[model samples]
Target: MSEWVDVHFQALETCGKRARSAANMLTVEDVFQDSSAKKPADAAQASMFGDLSHSGALAGKVNDVWSALKEELGTGRSRLQGVEKAIDQVETNLRKATKAATV
Candidate 1:
């Protein structure tokens, strides 16, 4: 007697495709670039600093945060691609093994 294992390849592929699409969408330039709030943040910071040679502008900080987030999204996208490839290889190997066993 042999135990049976069920794998849904279609579902796996669909999930991978959706994840990749989401990651790609986040990495697009328009997501957070030139956000409208930035101008107001800069103005507010300027009013508080009033030419005191301050280095803590809210707008700059916000930009740095956005840059870091974009970089992270890019990294996540790469990782998702690697994961999808690994899943494909696993599916192929499993199919080959199953065919060999059936024969």
Candidate 2:
């Protein structure tokens, strides 16, 4: 039983690490778009499953790390949306500033 627990714990850790890495990649990709238009929030949602390999383990939540990772991803997605919105606002302000300067 102990060995089995250890195995599952290691698996959970590995999943968390992979999820974190994928989250990083998604973040970079989301920000690196060719166009300046804001992406949908669902675009961020699309990243949440990139690293998930074990549906059974995720459903079990035996170690509770899976839940934590889900929360982390959710927070990361929200942060990405906020950053995108801020970027749009900044770009708009810059355009206005440039126009005013030209005037």
* Top-lDDT candidate index: 1
State each model's C-alpha RMSD to the native: 5.7, 23.0
TM-score of each: 0.58, 0.41
Off by over 4 Å in 2: 1-63
* lDDT over C-alpha atoms for residue 87 of model 2: 51
Residue pairs with clashing backbones, model 2 = none
10 residues in a row with least lDDT, candidate 1: 37-46
Please provide, for model 1 over 1-103, each residue's C-alpha lDDT reduced to its tens digit, 9 standing for 90 to 100: 1344344656666776776676676664646576754323232344455555653576466568766776887888788777777777776777778778988
Candidate 1 overall lDDT versus native: 0.64
C-alpha lDDT of residue 99 in model 1? 75
lDDT score, residue 33, model 2? 69
Q: Enumerate clash totals for all models, in the order shown.
A: 0, 0
Task: Write down the TM-score for model 2.
Answer: 0.41
Worst 10 residues of 2 by lDDT: 39-48
List lDDT for all candidates, in order. Answer: 0.64, 0.54
